[model samples]
Target: MPYPSSDTPAANPSPADSRAARLWEALPGLSYGADYNPEQWPEDIRRQDVELMKEAGVTVLSVGIFSWAWLEPSEGRYDFAWLDGVLDSLADAGIKVALATATAAPPAWLVLKHPEILPVAADGTTLGPGSRRHYSPSSSVYRRYAARMTRALADRYGDHPALALWHVDNELGCHISEYYGPEDAEAFRGWLRRRYGSIEALNDAWGTAFWSQRYGGFAEVQPPAPAPTTLNPTQQLDFQRFSSWALIDFYNMLAAVIHEVTPDVPTTTNLMASSATKSMDYFSWAKDLDVIANDHYLVAADTERHIELAFSADLTRGIADGKPWMLMEHSTSAVNWQPRNLPKLPGEMARNSLAHVARGSDAVMFFQWRQSRQGSEKFHSAMVPHDGTATRVWREVVELGAALKALAQVQGSRVESRTAIIFDYEAWWASELDSHPSQDVKYLTLLRAFHRELFLRGITADLVQPGADLSGYSLILVCTLYTVTDAAAANIAAAAERGATVLVSYFSGIVDQHDAVRLGGYPGAFRELLGINSEEFHPLPQHGTVGLDNGWKGRIWSENVRLAGAEAVVSFTGHPLAGVPALTRRVVGSGAAWYLATFPDDTSLAGLLDSLLAESGVAAPATAPAGVELTRRLGAGGASFLFVINHTGAEADVAASGRELVTGTQFSGVVQPGAVAVIVEDAPGGQPG
Candidate 1:
């Protein structure tokens, strides 16, 4: 099979694609609004919502997200009177609608009738339908009902003047990503037959010969459910793949109906694309979505949560192939899901929303419009808090709306970066499997740390897929990619050979796509390109650290690395494997390949990245204080927008001159503390300095 590349033309559509073009034509400006659940409110309150939405400068709203029961009170019965009124009211108020198919949750009647549609956990616990996303991804009965609901929606609203896009379903793979029910087992076998083609091929790929797990036929295989002991790692990996594909397959089934009914209208589904969401390989799903949209919420526990938001936004932009994407949901204040949902401080909401815009998002929206009076998400913050429009959240929502309106020209712009970070969802799933050399080797640990360092340095990096075209990137960072296809490995090596600086971290390139070890040595795929090989891993205990010859501390991992044809940049100072190279650099043509055999502390990692940046000539967009974040988005005719976010307590000075979109004033490069600015550069050439 060919390695998946994000650069594949068919997978990533251009900004001028008809779907994106139609979306822009419908919304006309930077979109602002939330998930509007008028079904939960009375007609009087629904009328009040339009008035408030107009005042807030909301241009769009996602309607009928959880309205399955409301749409159809009983099986084979339908009602669209309430939804008709809602859409008409929004249209009268000049707000567009991303009308949902209303199949996120099955109604009580449908689920009660076909209980097998519910998802079963790995331990055989069936999840009921009280919560959203309760249906199994592979349930044929569920898909049939969902398709019918979708057709009903598209048929009714296909020609509605207010319809902008067809929201296929709510956040997919959110609560119930995997299922182990009878339906899922049958679906998994069918998917395996399609993927492997033959039982012999399946056995070969799974390496089932080990532990007597080989199968006589595809029927003998099953989901990696509860077992007597440790289950097969390959089986677990394949199940993850199958679960993700099943959801996409389900999405396609609904999308096809929408296309058939309303071929002109674009269709999309909100994806949980942040670091917290790992169940779906969104890169694979991006091809199916007419426009990429994602939901992100700040982790209340993380002090630097905004950095994580930037990372997520950047990754989403990468999934969109550098095109503008939509931020379907975020929060105006505190979210109900976290253990301790902390309310946003004054101006924090604007900063959060604009941070996403600064990265690549063309629209900024939230999870809900009005605060729920009663439900599981009653406490979840919204555009209108329980205190009505008199609260801080409401004021911020209005202010954010006005700000987005002022920055309307920033839409359709693209964030450009010469540095690329290789991010693979399958690799993330495979590397974090059980029984690894170290449990501390988390998939996102290194990527997040490195992205934070880059953010602090004001250097924007694109999260590219493994098999993507790498020749354009001046610097490529491959961190802990334990599983990779041979084609992807060759692509990275080719990038380095073509004078692109490449960095490969520890435990990478150890296994093939099938989770089988490469025959030669550790980091087997890139050993020749990296000019190094390791015989074994030396993972440290919890909270343990190792010293390096360069005075850096290595934690969580160390390796018995031996330089094959490269020079050691840093070596282990002492231990059972004393004087071993901790870091090595190999000169390949005009470029260099650097290898880190262990994880370094933050300060050391920053220093090493600084060195790499200097060597590769990748500099920050502008000079600013440590806490200020800078990113640039380029548009047509050599136009650029500079986004400066100051997270520090003290005001900072940056070397930039432009008309600030946030304040509508000429910026002299001075930014106030805890504020955000999007500056439109005055110069004709918008290249970053």
Candidate 2:
């Protein structure tokens, strides 16, 4: 039931734990297939389709993803007769059901029956509801129906062997949180009481005196009205926190119902990437989930950069502490949501799938299985296409399935490497929320500067959680951590003391968890680690960055940095803020801490990071070169799966001595444009020989 639609809860992992044991048993040869619906097809077609799935070795079926209408045809009169039959059919075929809540969208019957479930928009316009995820997350009536519907389904089929996993209310966080509805206001008041205990505490934390946001009572507090320009920072941040917690509560309620009824079966909700429209505190829910799986879909070949997508994949892995996770939904050839839906050519799909495995994905699966006969996701790609498995996409899916089955134990295997990238969510939330020198200066921009260099150098950098232990890795990178938390700062300090080389960027540690400014200079919480006292940071436009004390020309927005114990490794040529130390290095026990004052463009960032990593004795993949991306996974064979991805527009030479997993033929030259090869080797082979 779990792996591939992955398993094993984070925060606790041991073979002795019953749930952990079940999850572990389920993970080996764990298979994933998207929601399958042949309900609309003829009997003969349905008959053959069932046989195909078994032949393909598909073990998990995400059933009834969009079957709201079929399950509840009338108000209070559920009709699971069809779904019962579908489950029976799949059970006969040895497939496990990741049951859907069927309330992603209420049936037209429910909407027509109770139109009050419709939600209002932020601009104060009532949206005429006839869509999925239309009810405000805080709507009482919607909650009643959702809970009732889920409980009924669970009670009905909880004991069924085919009923393996419960997917409660798909992608629970959608669009954004409620802002205008009456239900939202009520929920916000309740949440305030729970969070701050009373209006007085809330007032103190929000610093309500500045703009008279102080409330007389919990009931008196309402979601603040955004100004014609922008909402006040205190109010805005509270709202963001409120909204994220609001969705999490909804998911918790749904998961609770399932756990109460069928504790044996695993339960999970699909998580979206950080770029998601809704921001839920996943770190808070990581332990609550059966498995922390996400739908990661960022991809690029020759048209865009690979570093962005690669970082995304790494974050998904880090979400569950490198405990194997799933790629819940993917497009076979091309995706529907992007600005340009570019079909993956030749080896791209296989390459990307292996890359996820290289990162930490247990299984890869598509969004919708049947290629939706109706609805918005009808165009979404799947393993078995709309036209059936005759297409090139189907062949690729079959090939991938075969490969995964052959490599049965690879799903839950851990990847071993000497490089790691540190991402702090507080840092991410803090930097952007800080009312500072530049709102445009973001955590992502600095991360790109740091990771781009690693990608260019062919290093499989682990995207690690902020508080993760870094004693194993040779280097730990902290880039533009704007909101450095006390716990995270301690981890970095400890890592530095443990002899790890850390790279920190400007805008690091400027604020606290509440998005409040840290008082002592800039980078308040983390000032001591880098041994630099930063004063005012001037936001530099493109031209403001120029030559530094080092040979490389500093690019991107430059910050005016001040120093104390740490000296400038890279400095300005000859200008105000020039000799102020653009880059500084400090000794923290046995480790070294390097801080960058600004985000540098690709050329400069790569140059500086490469120099630092080389000096630290970190190793790079042998086949990697400029524009040739490399990812590796260490396996039981003492073999490392080295993935070579060429992001350039032209072919590049790549030399490998051992076997190439993608191609049977041997290679010892440049890798072509978009060429992906998984070469198995021993111990990274001493860095490209």
Candidate 3:
């Protein structure tokens, strides 16, 4: 039987897209859960866990994600007795299951039997069998064993009463992400052969002649390992691409087995930190998931972290194309891994969870339910903290659970944004190559800065891929897009032609997919769309600063920008290229294009964006102070909601006239400090009185 995961394969607007659709269609109302590890506790403790889960309003439990060792202690000797009892008990308590395939951590027996399956570091050190995810992604032997385990689990629990979703491996590229053994070398060679048909083509694309590092055959090429000197940029780029695909291929193999055995279950794996992770391209991986899921942890040390969290949530929602997703893992309080684990202040935990929902997450979940008594994550906070239900974390968890239950009306809703920020993994990979102009040119840092500007102004931006449907957005920002593919360039140009405001910042449109420059000039692919020409990249010294004619500072990067058919918008104040146009704008048909030749400071970037937004006739969500984030989600039949989040210590007024969903009071007042309020409006895009 064919499962109805999705009826259509278009890029967006699938009938069965959001997690809310699949989960709510099976079970009504919102989802609240955590990663359950019952095997860690005794049967008596597990009985207590069930009662607490009911009290906490947890409808779903992500079970068996790391239970492979317990399920099959010895090869071929199955033991589902304990799991069966756990599932049955949970079902009796009315809790559904997001059934994990349990392939994330293989048992010691398998790794000990085939040590060759262990991942080898780039330094030629083979990782030992002590930790989890030690298996090599490129090892065929590992795949064979993983597939066997997957088939067995799916066959046994295909029609289980508690099964709701299928989770494939935990955090695909956490550890063992990059492999450099003979197996990986062989795999890399094959990947290269597929990407570039002939050795001559490969050499030409890699520009191997620069360092006398030409390869005559594909077999001679090696996985870019720790070299005695600087490694080849193209080789490193391909290896990153190959490693990402290797993990994806592993997921596909497991998903095939689950589909064959339990076709009705939708498959997904948790994606972690899209801006931080380098190996996996989530935009590509999102297609495989019937419902996209992500694990987000805030930089609690930063005072403005809520803004970053909102950015991550918006990016994840954009990857799902406005579909509601799952917040698979987050901390109830302080996480243990950071340098300093600062517990969330009063009301901050609920604010963090609801921020995700306010953006577009349907399910609010965490890494673990109960805090561990022993392990590397013993200090990590949980739904039930170490102090039991009497603690502040517990009270907040219970409060968030009640809030989610009351949010049943908001289920299946989509958050819509007229602004988009283009984020490409390939561009991030290429821009950070070894021999770049400045080591300070971090891609995510700059992108996040631009995103924070829009966010501070109470505007939500979709973190879109280059090929995403730009027709839906009015303002598009492509910041530091150093690597430009032909298709990606055309997509932006087409968007500009269709009357969208386009902004291409410094260091953009410089290289192609092969890590090679687009020969004639800088920003070769996007010069025409931007209506400006650049000759070279002029990187500033470390901690260097320059002045912009608009009274804002420019720092870290500057380019020699000259006008072709566009008019100058901002010029350098005192530099060798003074009055040579720091920024330019061009009117293309009904749309307009603007180019910034240097990385502007935050104040400058904000002013530039303000001008652009005004010129494009786009309005912010209503005038509010900084640290107050705003977003709007729409339900079927004209139901609209306004979400106001105040991330600061000072109270701020949220201008709205409607019924507040969480408190059931009439809206329009000063939102409390470190608080969140959801108001249901009478019409979409309704302004405050």
Candidate 4:
């Protein structure tokens, strides 16, 4: 089968889909590669690397990521001889290149000459150089230097035969993400001035009058710096937003340089572990990129690793608007940074890579091509381990590469879902701020609870922002949305009017984007749509539980809700808020809105979601056992590819029969532990037996 071309036009979708379709139309086949730093190895070793690249079926390599010092040994001095050789060698081996600007890390000489470029912490301590990503995003000196270097590199290699993509400044906002230096303070103040005309308006928006934190002028307004006591939460939240934008501006600078030099070359910066960090708002950053790329590492501490991986991948795909994205970096096995550093069980790595591909990743890549004997990530697994091709990691690397070849037909496909969960960065930052009614009122906790239940049912939901177009979805979940805007509320209302069932959880719509309480009772903007009014919040003690009349227990939070036009689906039992609605549903125009005033346990949440799914006429594609994840990708040519991944330690079965593309066998029954089954659709799934 021929791979989809970069010029294939897609059918009509929403406006967002059209923008995403343009991106998808520029990407052709699945890119299988790794980040190769041939600068680390000797001449002979570099030559041998090409053979290993071919052996592992590597098609692309991201070179010169951290080679800033090597590329420019001294001020105004150039040394592209090594990189020129590496690029030429890779081209000779039929491997493409995602060339880096090599400006992510400045050399020691530059850092020493311009020490003001180093980042500072909230406590006003300047971070010394030695580590990567230490430059302040707002530093003028750093920006000038980085931009000049980026321009030179782009101009030199813009038309290189091996150049396939341009990777702008590696992993923006990873380490030293938020800077609080003098330069950053000035930049933050400028950002605030542009946002609010004067200090008085800023004071009012920050609600600084209550704590006597009112700013006398723009100079008085500083980022939420460390103090003896608790800093103002709203100020800190705004600073976080400013810091993210500053870093984004840093990325945009390099991107501008690259675009001016090489307009046709697509550019992207790897967004790292968004599920774990809320430093950067990816939704805003996604708009700036020609292609969206992400680096996802498993949270070793989480017991349900697969679920978290799926959530992150699905979220990344959603950020791409179901367009093909690049899995820029992932470990082949054990990552060195985690405390435990547990090696993945056999076949686990393959399963994890395929999970990303199943979601929407057109490219599957790892961090490093060869293991490092030095540096901070020496122990991190690589495609070619220190033991070379004689190791298990190498074997699995070859196997996964071959599997990707066989699954090339899945390229340019998109995952379609009738369900979507609102994952907002502003809400996450606002809800996690100090001084919430309950300390446990988290954004991801509630989101994952609902998402895990849907995952178990073999249902895939698109993770979207609160204000995204929901007309394409049948069921939409807004969980722990403490901060909401009028436009977002209107979008939800419109979706409900269009016959979509919108389910909202506790602590939603309680505050605006400014972090001010939405007066006129709780759930300010959504009161009319949800058909419920909340009076007061009853935050339970830690590890507390409240029994409900529907044989379910509520945890973490419960609210005093009075029904307006909605009917109570679940009421509190034997509590102070007895007979008051814990969960209520109301019909709004053509659709329905259900509000849960308290957090429900797994069983209760699952039961509630099942009812919501049934009411919306949404069902799983097939009946699969627990620990088995099933998702489908639809190609532009009307081909459907189903991925079944069994993440358990034992065998599990799915009720669908197809030709298992991975093993080239007819699979009808069971899949072994840590196994993945890629099935090209021959018959409709979930058909009546």
What overall lDDT goes with each candidate model? 0.89, 0.69, 0.83, 0.85
Instruction: Indicate the TM-score of model 4.
Output: 0.95
Tell me how many clashing residue pairs each candidate has: 0, 13, 1, 0
Which digits, one per residue and each the tens of the lDDT, describe model 3 over residues 22-72? Answer: 565765556898999998899998999999998899998899988999999
TM-scores, in order shown?
A: 0.97, 0.90, 0.96, 0.95
lDDT (tens digit, per residue) of candidate 1 on 148-177: 889988889999989998888888888778
| Regions of model 4 farther than 4 Å from truth | 1-27, 664-670, 683-689
lDDT of 4 by residue, 191-225 (tens): 99999998888998889887788878899888787
Instruction: Name the lDDT value of residue 207 in candidate 2.
Output: 73
> Which clashing pairs does model 1 show?
none
Report how far residue 301 has shifted in candidate 3, in Å: 1.3
Question: Which runs in model 2 stand beyond 4 Å of their true positions?
Answer: 1-17, 39-42, 274-278, 299-302, 542-544, 621-623, 627-629, 635-689
- Candidate 2 per-residue lDDT, tens place, 10-45, comes to 455432235534654654564666667655666676
**Pairs clashing in candidate 4?**
none
Ranking by TM-score: 1, 3, 4, 2
Report RMSD for candidate 1: 2.9
Model 3 pairs whose backbones collide: 509-523
